[model samples]
Target: MKKLQLIGLILVLAISYQCKDAKKETQETMSDEVEATEVIVEEVVDVEIITFKMEPKSESMVQGEVTFTESDGMVSMSAVLSGLTEGEHAIHIHEKADCSSDDGKSTGGHWNPTHEPHGKWGAVEGYHKGDIGNFTADEEGNAVVEFETDQWCLGCDDENKNIVGKAVIVHQGVDDFTSQPSGAAGPRVSCTGIIN
Candidate 1:
């Protein structure tokens, strides 16, 4: 009877050890599969990249370069600007590509293909497609703007939401996010045309 009991215990211990080993192998295999899938997905979702070079206007020292990436039907914009005062500055997209004027007015008013009223970017009502809100500069006269939106498109397929060939403007004052014709964002200090 003692020998039989010892044999039974040994068999149970062996089965338990085998089960743990099998579970570990399965977990490792699953982990490998997940990593492989992630790589494939990253390869499939290629982003479309576009760039712009800003020019100073009206004797202002403001200038910068901005890059826009389109992915998954969304556009992400990043800019590094310099020679700005230490305060918030409003930025928007204008109707034309021309920035020949000294005051940046040659770019025209805010891009408003939809003919909508001027308001904040995320406003539920009465907001222009060009309303990009504002960004703040540090004491060193430098500012970085990073924003993303699904409302704007890179190509010119949709006239109202298309940003390609339009002008980007950086204002001299903060965007109040209210008021008419551009949130009273003040004068255009920097301007650039977006292109592929």
Candidate 2:
């Protein structure tokens, strides 16, 4: 009887130890799963977008819409325009967001926060921050201009990179890329104020 009782006690202890070990393993697994869930939640990012309309300037019938999208430290601009002459034209970001004047000169000169000279967008010699070059209008007088850059921002703290208080100007002629000040891109045909 004593031997039987001793054997039974040993069996109970062994079973209890295994149950405790199993519970500990389950708790550890639960902790690891929680950490993985937290890591996944931290990887999300935010995107910002702004859209505005472009009006005719300098007695031209040109009109359009401009959109700016910011994502992962990069800004993209898309402009859809109509009522243009069927040929190449110049587009740029001017210093001020004001478009009150009939000639679009109220927006001031090209956006040159860095005081760089006029040239191509990525010219080795020099280039203004607003030197966006040129795009062609289709036979139907409709054009879609798309540009992307990490050098510009929307409603950001950096004054040199922020584009909120600026203007989009579509010129009637092509950008020579060698002219000083404003690239001699001809009359501003379309204008839009980029307000925050």
Candidate 3:
């Protein structure tokens, strides 16, 4: 009977040790799972977006809404316009966000933070940051414009790359690309301020 009792005690201790080891392993696994979840959360990226409306300028009937989305250091611009003539037109970012003027001149010249010459976007000869080129309007005088680039930011610290406190302008004619100063894109027909 004494030998049998000793054996029974030894068996209980072994079983208890196994249960404790399993519990410790489960806790370690849970800790590892929590760490992996934190890593996943840290890897997530943030996306920023801003949208505004375009008003008619320079005695033209052009009007539109513009949206700017920033993600992964790239900025994308989308504009939906109506009341434009049935043909090609030019769009660009201007120096100021002010659109209080009647003729859209309040927005000033093209946004040339780099002080580069006016030319086509991605031109080897150099171009303004705002040189967005052109888009065509449908026979119904409506148009949609989409532009994307990594050279721009929204309310960032880089003054040369940030697009806040700027203006978007729609011109009455096509961008000549070779014209100095403004590409001779004709009169500013629509204007909108890009604010925070």
Residue by residue across 104-194, what tens digits does model 2's lDDT show? 9999999999998899999998899999999999999999999999999999999999999999999999999998888888999999999
Q: State the lDDT at 181 in candidate 2.
A: 85
TM-score of each: 0.77, 0.79, 0.79
lDDT of 1 by residue, 47-106 (tens): 788888899987889999989988878899998999998989999989898898999998
Off by over 4 Å in 3: 1-45
After superposition, which runs of candidate 2 have C-alpha atoms over 4 Å from their true positions?
Answer: 1-45
Q: In candidate 2, which residue pairs clash?
A: none
What is the RMSD, in Å, between candidate 2 and the native fold over all Cα? 5.0
* Predicted structure 3, TM vs. truth: 0.79
